[model samples]
Target: MSLPDFSGTTPQERLASLRRSVAGRIVFTTSFGLEDQAITHMIREGGHDIEIVTLDTGRLYSETHAVWAETEQRYGLRIRSFHPDPQALAALLDDWGANGFYHTKDARLACCGVRKVEPLKRALAGAEAWVTGLRADQSQARGDVMAIEFDTGRGLAKAAPLHDWSREDVARFCETNGVPVNALHAQGYPSIGCEPCTRAVKPGEPERAGRWWWEQDDAKECGLHVDADGKFVRAKEAVQ
Candidate 1:
């Protein structure tokens, strides 16, 4: 599976090129953050040939849901949503109890594995390209993200159109294009995740300071961005 070296002066143009390059379905997964919203806006407004989808962790903030709905209505597109398996959810609750992720890093990662990463695996099933709204300055783990890379774990090419964009670049695009964004961003939540794990960043904190604030020392990822071999969490089905 060799992918061509795509070229463009802008992210949208590069994305269009990528879309043209792929022969099968190209999926774009959004978390409804500022960066994701920006990418969604570009995908919808440009009318590119790609499928838009999301993972409903079932533990998101109302604000996150609001923005998700708003993006749908604003673009007049129904973004498909994948949710955690009901059986898996019940087993997680029985074993860890609600809010158990707050007690330990392992528990948190397991919760993420069940709630986010597993659903993402389904959402990305059979996709030729997986586009995401990742920026270089987002965090240390993701600082090396290139415009495109092959995800051997998923057996597909992954694209990060906004890889070199700055936070200000995303904000500006969202504002100028009227993209629906999470309301929490205005209240100092530079990074938004599940309501229980995320918080408002303090002054001088990094952009992702709000996510999993209790973990004093860890990368700000939920297993999605990490390499297949270096997954941030262990995704598995619940015991029957």
Candidate 2:
């Protein structure tokens, strides 16, 4: 599926063009963070025909849920929710016990696979394109992200409209547009993921330092962004 060349176009224009170009569905996955809120505002207020979706890990913070609700109300759009497969989740728990992710990197990736990655795969099925709120400054792993690329893992074109935006850029857009954002950002959480695996990063730390802070070397990805090299592959192919 060849995507439209978005060179020299604004993010809004690019998104609109992408929507028009794709014959199949174009989906955007949001975590309800500041960046996602900014993109959500563009999709909603700009009247782009795109499906907004999110993964419910069943372990998200209450504040995240509040922001999700606020976003829906603000934009008057429904953000589709996907969940982990019940049998997969149950089998993971039975094998590793609850909270087994704390023991090893493989265990942690396994938990994230059940909670985030698998759900995202299901959410993106049949979609010609998937949009995300990824920014270059978020982490070294994402530093080289492009505005558009073919996602080999999911066999779809991936777009990151905020690829060149900085944290301040996202915040400013949200502030100026009155976009609903998660309140955790004000309390030092630069990035917000599932409740247990995320924390507040100290000053001077990387934006994603709060996520899986215990893991010193593993990339801070939840399998949603695995590229050709398969940097953070899931632990088990079959859930059970």
Instruction: State which candidate has the highest lDDT.
Output: 1
Using TM-score as the measure, which candidate wins?
Answer: 1
lDDT of each model, Cα atoms only?
A: 0.84, 0.83
Model 2 clash pairs are none
Put down candidate 1 lDDT per residue, 1-240, tens digits, no spaces.
Answer: 776455686898888888888889999999899999988888887899899999999999999999988988998989999999999989999989999999988888889989998999999998988988877788876667778777767878878889889999889988898777899999999988899999898998888888898888657678887755544322121100
For residues 65-117, write the lDDT of model 2, one tens digit per residue.
Answer: 99999988888878899998999999989978888887887888889999998
Error of 2 at 229 (Å): 5.0
Q: Model 2 Cα displacement at 195 (Å)?
A: 0.5
Report residue 148 deviation for candidate 2 (angstroms): 0.2
Worst 10 residues of 1 by lDDT: 231-240
Quote each prediction's TM-score.
Answer: 0.93, 0.93
Off by over 4 Å in 2: 232-240
Model 2 — TM-score against the truth? 0.93
